[model samples]
Target chain A: MLKKRIIPCLDIKDNRTVKGINFENIVDAGDPIELAQRYVLEGADELVFLDITATQEKRKTLTELVRKIAAEINIPFTVGGGINSLEDAKAIIESGADKISVNSAAILNPELITEISKQYGNQCVVVAIDTKFVNGEWMVFRSGGKISTGLKAVDWAKKAADLGAGEILLTSMNNDGTRAGFACEITKQISEAVSIPVIASGGAGTREHFAEVFQETNATGALAASVFHFGQIPIPELKNYLKTQNIPIRI
Target chain B: MIAILKYNAGNVTSVENAVQNLGYSTIVTDDVKALRSADKVIFPGVGEASSAMKYLKEKGLDQVIRALTQPVLGICLGMQLMCDSSEEGETEGLGIFDAKVLKFPATALVPQMGWNNFTSLKGKLFDGINLENDCYFVHSYYAEICPDTVAVTDYILPFSAALQKNNFYATQFHPEKSAKIGLQILNNFLKL
Candidate 1:
C-alpha cells in the first residue's frame, strides 16, 4: 500500500534556509543541509525547498544548494520557485533534485508543463497550484497570490493532469499561514477530478489536520512549513498520531 | 567501475548521488564501451516508455545493455523496460524478466506514489533488509508478479516490487530515493 506522504516545506533566501525556524540544535538555521539532515532524522517522507531568491543571478546558487542537499539527503526532495523554463528545470535536476515544482511559470504557460514532462519524465515534473476561494469559486493564484487566473481550482488541476503532470501540489492561499486545517472541500474535489496524486499544502496545524486531508480527500501527501520549522509538530510524532488513527502514513 | 545508464529518462543524477554516497565511484553515460566494461551497471530511469525505448534503440546502446553479463540493476522505469513488454505505448521490453508491465487501474490512483513495504523477500538483492520496511515507489505502471519476483508489494493489487533472474536485477520502486532502508538495499546490491 502506498502510504500518505508527510512533506516539510522550507524557504531559501540567498542560498540559506530561513523563515519561521527557531531550533537550537541547528548549527545554522540558514543552512539547508543541516536542516535537511535533521528532517531525515525526523522521518520526513520528502522535503520541499522553495527558493525565495529565485532571481536569474541566484538561480545558479539554487542549483548549487540542491547539489549540497542531494549529497547529504537520500530521500526525494523537490526544488521549486523561479523554474521558468526547460533549461531551468534541467539545471536543478542536474544539481540532483529528485523532482522540480513549477508554479508561476506553469500557470503562465500551461504547455510548459507538457514540455517539461516531455523533456524530462512526468515523474520529474510537479505542477504546484496556489488556489484560493475567490468570488465564490476557488480560483488559481499567481505572483504569490496577488494575481488570480480566474480559472476554477479543480478545473486547473484537471488541466495540469491532462498536460501530463505526474502530481499536483495544491496549496490553498486562504488556508495558508493559518493553523486551522486544510481546505478539504477543494482538495477532495480536485483529487476526484484528476487521476494523478494530489499533495495538499497549507494550513496543517495539528496532526489531525494531516489526517483530515488524507481521510476527507484522496490527498496523497500533506505539507507544512511553520509547524515543522517551529518544531510544534515533530514529524515522527505526527506519523505516530496518524498511524494510530488508522491512516496509512509513512512511519 | 559503477556505470549508471543515462538516456532520455530522468533520475540519473539522483541515482549517481546515491551511488557516490554508497562510497562507490560511478559514471552516468550512454557510451557503449564504458557500459560494457563497467564492473556493475545501474540502469535507472524516469520517462515515457516508447520514447525511452526509441532513445535506447537509436543510441544502439540497447544491444550493449542486452549483452552485459555483470550484475545489472534496474530501477523503476529501468525495471519496466527490462520486462518482456509494457502496456504503456504498447512498447516491447528487453525480455529479461519474461514479464509484462501493466498500468494500475484508474479506480485506484494511477501512480501509487509513496513509501510502500516489501514482504516475502528473497535473493541477495534484499539480504539483511527487513521485509516489513517500507520503500519509496513512484510509477503509474507495474510489472506483473512472475517466477523471477523476489519481493511483493500490494497496492490496488499485489505486484512484483522486486525481480531477479540470473545476473539481471530490477525494482519497481526507487530504492535510491527510499531513505536509509533504501540505501541498505543498494548496499546489498553493491555487495552482490
Candidate 2:
C-alpha cells in the first residue's frame, strides 16, 4: 500500500528555517540541516524547503543549502521559491535536491512548469498553488499568497497536471497559520480533479487535522510548518494516531 | 569504482551522493570505458522513456550497457529502460529484462508518489532489509511482473517493485530517497 506522507515544510529565509503565518509574520524556527535530520529520524515521509529569500543575488545560497541538506539528509525533499527559470531549477536539482517546486514562476509563465518538467522528468517537478477562499470560491494566489491570480484553485491544479506537474502542493492561505485544519473541501476538489498526487498544506494543528485531510480528501501528503517545528505535534505520535485511525502510514 | 551512468537523465547527483555516503567512491559519467571497467555500475535516471532511450542510443550507452558484465543496478526510469518496452512513449528498452512497463490505470493516481512497501522479496539485494518495508516510489508506469521480478508491490495493482536477472538489478523505487531502508538496499547492492 502507498502510505500517506507527513511532510514538514521549512520556510527558508536567508538560509535559516522560519515559519510564515498567513504569508506574513515570519519567525525563526531552527537550523534547516538539524531540523531535516531530526525529521528523518522521527520518520517524516518527506520534507519541503521553501526559500523565502527576497533577493535574486542570494538565490545561489539556497542551492548551497540544498547541496548541504541533500548531502546529509536521506529522505526525499523538495526545494521551492526563487526558482524562476530552468537554469534555476537545474542549479537546485544538480545540487542534489530530489524535486524543484515552482509557484509564482509557473503562474507567471505556465510554460515554466512544462520546461522544468521536460528538462527534469515530471516526477521531479512539483507545482505549488497557494490558494485562498475568496467570494465563496477558492482562487489561486501568487508571490507567497500575497497576490491573487484570479484563477480557480481546482481549475489551476488540473491545468498544472496537464502541463506535466508530477505533484500538486495545494496550500490554503485562509487556513494557513491558523492551525485550524486543512482546507478539505477545496483539497478534495483539487485532488479529484488532477491525475497526479496532491499534497495538502496549511492549517495543520493537531494529529487529527492530518487525519482529517487524509480521510476527507484524496491528499497523499499533509504539510505543516509551526506545528512540526514547535513540537506541537510530533511526527511519530501523529503517525501512530493515523495508524490507529486505519489510515495507512509509514512508521 | 561505482560508476553512475549519466546520459542527460536527472537524479544522478543524488545517487552519487548516496553512494559516497555509503563509503563507496562514485563517478557520474557517460564514458563507455569507465562504465565497463567499473566494479559496479549504477544506472540512475529520471525522465521520459523515449527521450531517455534516444539519448542513450545517441551516446552509444545503449550498446555498452547491454554488453556490461559487472553488476549493474538500475533505479526508477533506469529500471524501466532495462526492460523490453514501455507504454510511456511506446519506447523500446534495453531488453535486459523480459518485461514490459505500463502506466497505472486511472483507477488510482497516475503517479504513485510517496513510500510503498514491497512483498515476496528475494535475492541478496534485500538481504538485510525487512520484508514489506516501505520505500520511496514516484512513477506513473511500472514494470509488469515477470520471471525477473524479485519483489512485488501492490499499488493500483501488483507490479514489480524490484527485478533481478543475472548481473542486472533494477528497482522501480528510489532507494537513495527512501531513507534508512533505502540506504540499506543501496548498501546491499554495493556489497553484492
Candidate 3:
C-alpha cells in the first residue's frame, strides 16, 4: 500500500531557512541541513524547501544552499519559489533538487508546465496552487496570494494535470496558518479531479490534523512548516500518532 | 571509484552527489573504459524511454552497459532500460533482467510518485534496512515481477521493487533520494 507521506517544508530566504526564524523550541533551528537531518532521524518521508529569495543573485545563493543540503541529506527534496523557466528548473535540479515546483509562473503560462515536464520527466514537475475561498467558491491566487487569478481551484488542478503536472501541491489560504487543519473539501475535489497525486498543504495544527486530512481526502502527502519547525510536532511522534489512528504513514 | 553511467539521462548529477555523500568519489562519464575500470557502475536516469533508448543506441551506451561485469545498479528509468524491453517506447532493452517495463494502467494513477515500502527483501540492497523500509519512487512505468525480482512493492498491483541477477542489480526506486535507509542500501551495494 502507498504510505501517506509527511513532508516538512523549509522556507528559505537568502539561502538560510527562515521558516524557523520565530521557532523558539529548537535552538538554532534556522540551519536547514541540521533540521533536515533531525527530520530524517525522526522519519520524515520527504522535504520541501520554499526559496523565497528576492534577487537573481540571492537565487544563486539558494541553489548553493540546495547543493549544500542535498550533499548532506539523502531524501526526496523539492525546491520551489521563483522558478519560472526551464533554465531556472535546470539550475535547481543540477543543484540537486529532485523536483521543482511552480506556482504563479504556471498560472501566467500553463504551457510552462508541459514544457518543463517534457525536458525533465513529469515526475519532477510539481505545480503548486494557492487557493482562497472567495465569494463562496475556491478561487486561485498568484503573486504570493496577493492577486486573484479568478480561476477555480478544482478546474485549474485538472488543467494543470492535463498540462502534464505530475502532482498538485494544494494550499488553502483560508485555512493556512490557522491550525484549523487542511482544506479537506477542496483537497478531495482536486485529488478526485486529477489522476496524479495531490499533496495537501496550508493548515496543519495537531497530529490529528494530519490524520483528518488523510482520512477525509485522498492526499498522497501532507506538508507543514511552523508546527514542525517549532518542535511542537516532532515527526516521529506524529508518525506514531498516525499509525495508531490506522493511517498508512511511513515509519 | 564509482562511474555514473551517463547517456544524457537526468539525475546523474544528483546520483554523483549521493555517492559522494556516502564518501565515494564518482566520475560521470559515458566512456566504456571508465565504466569498465570503475569499482562500481551506477546507472541512474529520469526520462522517457523511447527517446532515451534512441540516444543510448546512437552513443552505443546500450552495448557498453550490457557488457558490464561489475556490480551495476540501475535506478528508475535506468532499471527499466535494463529489462528485455519497455512498453514506454516499445524499444528493446539490454536484456539483463528477464522482464518488461510496462506503463501503469490508466485504471490507476500513474507515476505513483511518493515514498512506498518494500516487502519480501532477499538481497544485499536491504542490508541494515528494515523490512518495511520506505523508499522514494517516481516513475510512470514499472518492471514487472520476474524470476530475478528480490523485492516487491504493491501499488496498483504487485510490481518488482528490486531485482538482482548475478552482478547486475537494479532498484525501481531512487535510493539516492530516499534518506538514511536509502543511504544504507547504497552502502550495502558498495560493499558488495
Candidate 4:
C-alpha cells in the first residue's frame, strides 16, 4: 500500500527560506538546513526545496545548500527551481537529492524531460506546472507565475507524462498563499489525465484543507508552506486526522 | 573497509555515504578481487532483476560473490538477486536463499514506495531497531517469506523485509535511505 505523503515545501533564495503573504512581501524565514531538520522531526513525509532566485549568486548557494541538507537529513528531499538542463538535474541528484523538479525548463524544451529521464530513471524526474484559471480554461504559468503560457493545464500534464515524467507537481498560482483550499477542479482534471502520481500544491491553511485536497482530488500527496512554517498544523496531527478519515497514512 | 558491489543499479552513493558516516571506508567496485578481499561485501542495487543479473555474469562477479566467505549484505534488488529466481524479467538468481522474488499483483500497488514498519525481525540488522520501526522502501518486486526470512513487512500482503542464511544477509528496503533506524541497521552490519 502506498502511503499518502505530507510534504513541507521550502522556497529558497540566497540560502534563506523566503515566504510571502501572497507571493509578495518576501520575509526571511531562516537557514534551509535548520528548517529541514525541524520539519523532519515534526513528521514531514518529505521536503521540497525550490530555489526561487534565478540569479547566479543564488544558484551557487542552492547547490551548496542542497549538499548540506542531503548530508544532514535522511528522508527523501526534492530540489527544484531554475533547473533548466540535464546537467543541472544530474548535479542536484548527485548532491544527494532524491528527485529533481523542472517547471519552465520542461515547457521550454519538452525534450529535456525525455533526455533527463533517459539519463536518470523517470522516478528521479518530476515536472511541476504552475497553473491559473483563465477564461474558464486552465493555463500554465512560468517564472513564478509572472508569465502565462496558453497551453491547457491538462494537455500539458498529459504531454509531460508521455515524455516520461515520473510525477507531476501541480501548483495553483491563483490559490497559492491564499490558504483557501486547493484548486481541486484542475487537480482532479490533471490527475485523471495522467498515469503518474500527482502532488497537489498551493492554498492549504488547515488540516481539513489537506483532507479536502486528498479526498476531492486525485493527488497522491499534499504540499504546503505557511501553515507548516507557522506551526499552525503539525504533520503527525494531520496524519492522525487523515487516518481517522480512512485515508492511508504511514503511521 | 566495506566494498559495495557496483553495477548498473542506482542509489550506490547513498550506501557509500552511509558507510562513510559510520567511520568505515568504502569502495564502489565491480572488481571481483576487491569484493572477494574486502572485510565485508555490500551488494546494493535498484533495477530490474534480469538486466542486473546479466551484468553480474558479464563481469564474472556472480561466481566471486557466491564464493565469498565473509558476510555479504544485499539491499533491494541485491536481495532479490540473492534468491533462487525472480518473476521480474523471468530470470534466475544466485540461489543463496531458498526464496523466490515475484512482482506484486497489478491489482495491488505497482510500486510500493515510502516508509513501512518491519515485524518479526531476527538478525543483527534489527539490533536496536524495534519491530514497529519504519524503514523506507521503493520496489515493484518482492521475495516471499521463507525459512530464511528474518524480518517481514506488509503492503498488499506479507513479504520478507530481511533474509539471512549462513554468510549471506539481504534486505528488501533501502537501509541507507531509512534515517536513524537505517543508520542503526548499518552500524550493526558493520560490527558483524
**TM per model?**
0.94, 0.97, 0.96, 0.90
Docking class of 3: medium
Once model 1 is optimally superposed onto the true structure by TM-score, how far is the C-alpha of residue A48 displaced, in angstroms? 0.9
| Local accuracy by lDDT, each model | 0.87, 0.91, 0.87, 0.86
Residues B39-68, model 2: lDDT tens digits: 999998888899899999988889999999
TM-scores of the candidates, chain A only = 0.95, 0.99, 0.95, 0.97
Per-residue lDDT of candidate 4, residues B63-153 (tens digit): 8888999989999999999999999889999999999999887554346767788767887778888876778887778999999999999
Those runs of model 2 whose alpha carbons end farther than 4 Å from true positions after fitting are none
Local error of candidate 3 at residue A12 (angstroms): 1.2
* Winning model by TM-score: 2
The DockQ of each candidate is 0.76, 0.84, 0.77, 0.41
Better of 2 and 3 by lDDT: 2
Scanning candidate 3 chain B in windows of ten residues, the lowest lDDT window is: B6-15
Error of 1 at A102 (Å): 1.6
Instruction: Give the TM-score comparing model 4 with the true structure, all chains together.
Output: 0.90
Candidate maximizing lDDT: 2
Tens-digit lDDT track of model 1 for B1-192? 899998887767778878899899999888888998998999998878887888898888778888999999999999999999999999998889988999998778877778999767888988778767899998889999999999999989899999999899999888888888898899888888
Error of 2 at A215 (Å): 0.9
**Per-residue error (Å), model 3, residue A1:** 1.8
| Model 4 chain A lowest lDDT segment of ten | A54-63
Candidate 1 - chain A - TM: 0.95
